[model samples]
Target: MKHEFDSAFHPADIAFKTLKLAPHAWVPNNSRLPVLIYRRAVDPSTKDLGKTFEALLAGNEWLPQWRDSIFDYHHFHSTAHEALAVISGKAEVIVGGPGGEVVSVAAGDVVLLPAGTGHCLQSTEGRFQVVGAYPEGQQWDIRRDALLKEEIAAMEALPFPRSDPVAGRKGPLLQEWT
Candidate 1:
């Protein structure tokens, strides 16, 4: 299928980081799945950054769920994993609950959070717009706290996506998740 930006032509050697977050306080961050972070996953200079990210993720079977700024409070999803692409400005985001990893993201960067992983916005520059997505069959739930058994079970039960939202079939999500 021809895409708007040819699937947002990204670099073959797109650099990424994977974090396996342990449970923090009441937040049951994923024990089995590490959050995936891709730096410069797409070209920031594109005329239409959000559209590029949407098409790329859609092609990979991840739905372009919403376009907004990250929530200012710490929270997480229990039912569905999430993919976020920065389309405007920059942000300092905290992932894996309070005192979790603090990441700085800018336009063109992408973050894939496993179910039950915590995330919140710390601060931003410019417009701070983000495009969020979810795997094809999974819908998201906001949870700041969860019963250990229930949250862990729900998170563990979720299936890993077939392809990486940014890296396509060869994206790190497949290898690391499985």
Candidate 2:
């Protein structure tokens, strides 16, 4: 799991914003960690955006999980944190929950969500898709409702990733997530 990233492709030019979402309705937002959004993190001109993200994320130890469109339903993962890197098109994403903040994301945008944070797709402009990853050794489970105490505990129990998925060691996540 100690693989180094091929420096041939880099996503070092990132403009990130941090937003802390409070526990809302059925969404048990992370109590201490703020979500990270990186605008234009990737190079839109890259021929294989998905492959580039996979290499970048995997190098940081947030192993790439899937390449697909976001589910258009409010849900959260209690087992692990998630990173979504938009590879194509644009979309309006609900970041926190039903009454949470909404953001417009396009190609090259990346959103990092803490465990227990709610998310779903609101709408898309074109052929929208993302390459997602999670912290090493962490698995994921989809929960439509965060109604159980065990779920909350599971989310709170997870630890922060050692490095930012996109930026690697000196990433903004280290500065902002804590």
Candidate 3:
């Protein structure tokens, strides 16, 4: 899956949607940042969705950080924005907080989470896998549905990632986030 980011390539070619959040419990949903969902960002039938997705994100400066063996409970990061590219299998995910929205995602899907957005794996098909990454120089901190005053403040002050994990600086992420 060699992609040439030349004249023929445009970030808008990949379709995506933005999901806004309101304060929910200790999740402290990011009032300014929205979760991004890139539907079928990659072809599910591709031979190496993980590798391709990783390369795509890295190319846009979203540093590949971990393999998506995500936990089952709801959680969020207050210090960094994150991205998850589904490589194989399908899963039901809950986003926002306890009262968040639930979405079904499968291979070739990419989900971009801003700092302070809550997410959790509700269920999954066998052999589920994903590639996770973060913006350059960003570190992540995990928090459950309980938060401190300082944590809430920090989450509110966190800056948006400089680039979209799948589409670079000019991608919809900047347009929607900024």
Q: Give all TM-scores, in the order shown.
A: 0.93, 0.91, 0.89
Candidate with better TM-score, 1 vs 3: 1
> How well is each residue in 1-178 modelled by candidate 1, as lDDT tens digits?
1111122367566788888899899888889888888888888999999998999999999999899999999999988999999999999999989999999999999999988889999999999999999999999888877657866776788888888898778777777888
| Model 1 ranges off by over 4 Å | 1-8
> Which stretch of 10 consecutive residues in model 1 shows the poorest summed lDDT?
1-10
The backbone clash count of each candidate, in order, is 0, 0, 0
lDDT of 2 by residue, 1-178 (tens): 1112322345334577888899999998886998888877778778998887788899889998899999999999989999999999999999889978998999888899999889999999889999989999899889897558876776798988999887877777887776
Residue 89, candidate 3: alpha-carbon lDDT:
89
Q: lDDT tens digits, residues 23-72, model 3?
A: 78777778787788887787788898888888888988899888866678
**Model 2 score (lDDT):** 0.85
Candidate 2 global TM-score: 0.91
lDDT of the candidates, in the order given:
0.87, 0.85, 0.80
RMSD of candidate 3 to true structure, Å: 3.9
Pick by lDDT: which candidate is best? 1
